[model samples]
Target: MSLTHDATLRELPTEHGVLRYHEAGDPGAPPLLLLHGSGPGVTGWRNFGANLPLFAEHFRCLVLEFPGFGVSDPTDQHPMVAALPAVGRFLDALGLEQVDVIGNSMGGVVSTRFALAQPDRIRRMVTVGGMGRAIFSPSPGEGLNLLMEFTEAPSRERLIEWLNSMVFDRALVTEQMIEERWAQATEPSTLAAARRMYSRAALEGMAKAASTSPEPPYWAMLHQVRARTLITWGRDDRVSPLDMALVPMRTIPDAELHVLPNCGHWAMIEQKSAWEAAVLAFLTRKD
Candidate 1:
């Protein structure tokens, strides 16, 4: 079946809320969950809409909309915090025992955490940026600053700034893209959630809390992941710099790294063919 927006859209009621997702390909095919980033106005459809048809040809593509994002029900918890459980519940509702996952930015972080917490559930994992902490570059890089700035004050100019930071080529940030992002991003609840996640005050509080917390950061636990991971990054990623892939590359037992040149945070979008070729080979490889 052709993977169109309306044809693939689906929803499931879970205890947390009604979880929305886009599904394509044969139900009997191996499940491939595509988790989206935490950027303002981000949604599963927006993130993977272009690649869904391609991926659906090989595997059942499930593009899940994490809660606290405008596409799904709002939750009191931060979107990042809420995503892990939402993933588990979504899979449970679908009766999926194991699935391959492709995560972008914030989704990558959540996927790593999920793999650590429930090692057997994920078959193979692929992450596009936003996995590990910065080893060399400053934390919360330029793209993040722009993201926070826009979250703190929703303006078209700020949104465009943040969008520009997402890609190495600014031409990708078209008028329609900006308009769609602006409409969803400025929605009262969505904007409030963005503030909770990316506002200056929220960021500062998180840093302070983490500094005092005894719990080790997620990157430290990468060794425990049973899934073979493919960590993909854009050479010019401004949000989570290319250097952030270091820890995971060195740590995850059976991990491979793929760096796409002339790309930024949105590697999958900015370098679509290269990203897809590498990821498809990894996911389909018998070895």
Candidate 2:
């Protein structure tokens, strides 16, 4: 069967819940796990669907829908907290001992955390923004603020504002895109989960807790990532901002950085060909 979005739709029951994913490419090919961001209406398909055909040509592409995103089963734990275990379970379910990864925003953070925790499971990784701290730029940058705003109150206007911030070229935010996102973003279960992650109260609570937590933040531990990593960013990313990539680029022992100009938070989608070229080269490189 040919690979297409609907044709690739699949689900696997895991200890966490029913894990929904899109699978393409030969089952015999090396697996490539694609993880999506934490935007209000985000899903695995929405984030990486367009890139699947190209990636599937070389590797088995599995776009995982993280828990609490409406596409996957809902969980009481924060989505980020639920994500790590979901990844492990999904891989275990598929009998994939190790695989390459491509993560966007929140997914990047999750992938980094997973690599640190299970050093042997990730052969290589690529992250499109959201892997580090804001050394110079303001915390919770423009795109995040808009995201929180939309999560706090669901409105077509707010969703539009957030979508516009995702790409450097506003033209990418089409009416159909807005409508699809709006429908999903407003779903009662999805919106509630989003609040747990992006509401002002949640952000404040997390900050206050992090202030007293004994553990150092993940960015401080980037030096420990064992996998070869490609840290891709958009020069115009308003969400995480370009400065955030500095720490990961400089710290990850086996890492390289690529920043595409005239792009924003969604580098993989906004600068599709260039991002794919960079990622494919890194993943397939032998040195």
User: Candidate 1 lDDT, tens digit per residue, 1-287?
Assistant: 55778888898998888999999988889999999998878998988999987898899899999998898899888778889999999999999999999999999999999999989999999999999989999988999999989998789999999999999999999999999999999998888888889999999999998889999888888989899999999999988999999999998999999999999999889999999999999999999
- List runs of model 2 lying over 4 Å from the truth: none
Global lDDT scores for all candidate models: 0.92, 0.93
- Scanning candidate 1 in windows of ten residues, the lowest lDDT window is 1-10
Question: Which pairs in model 1 have colliding backbones?
Answer: none
Model 1's TM-score against the true structure: 0.99
Best by lDDT: 2
Overall local distance difference test of candidate 2: 0.93
Per-model TM values vs. the true structure:
0.99, 0.99
